[model samples]
Target: MLKNSLDCIEETGKGDISIWLTRGNEEDNFNYLNIMDTAKGIYPKQAEKIFESFYSDRKGGTGVGLAYCKMLMKTAGGDIYCKGKFNQFAHFILKFPKID
Candidate 1:
């Protein structure tokens, strides 16, 4: 995902990729990591579809990256999601639930 973000910003001369990690609220019992990039953002529909297997819009892209991440998170009893708007930003939130 970081590599993809870096590639997305290359055409514009400059852009930003930010990552933040935080302990989620006690009620949630999760830790959170956010990866946000200022680049050519994705449409709402596209964002949802990106996690599907074999979904790729990039040349030479195997398209398994995001889908694999989702699978790993689920296996760990966590979750992942993406949200963004066109020409604005792309944000991916990963939720890691705390073990008992």
Candidate 2:
């Protein structure tokens, strides 16, 4: 999802794109999922709404993917969020608890 989202932004040439990826697990902490996106013309706020149902900054998607992801994560005791600066990079993070 993260890659696809980035691809959407990159293909449009709306930003300088780069990705710093990470994944790890701590003994009593959470599993990590991170995707950082450099989108020169994309604001994190705009990206934040990407998850809304039927809302796509661009075209050609039902716009329910991120919403569905949120639902599935909540069902599995996890969550998703984004952090980014306007005309800078956007970071999307999803974390899940380590199951015993």
TM-score leader:
1
Tell me the tens digit of each residue's lDDT in model 2 across 3-34: 56567577757654444534454553667577
- Give one digit per residue, the lDDT tens place, for model 1 in 1-100: 8998998899665669999998977788999999999888879999999999999998788989999999999999999999999798999999999767
* RMSD, one per candidate, in order: 1.3, 3.4
List residue ranges in candidate 2 displaced over 4 A: 12-28
For model 2, what is the error of residue 73's alpha carbon versus the real structure, in angstroms, after optimal superposition?
0.9
CA lDDT scores, all candidates in order: 0.90, 0.68
Can you tell me which runs of candidate 1 are displaced by over 4 Å? Answer: none
Q: What lDDT score is found at residue 44 in candidate 2?
A: 56
Q: What would you estimate as the lDDT of candidate 2?
A: 0.68
For candidate 1, list the clashing residue pairs, or say none: none
The total of clashing pairs for model 2 equals 1
Every model's TM-score: 0.92, 0.69
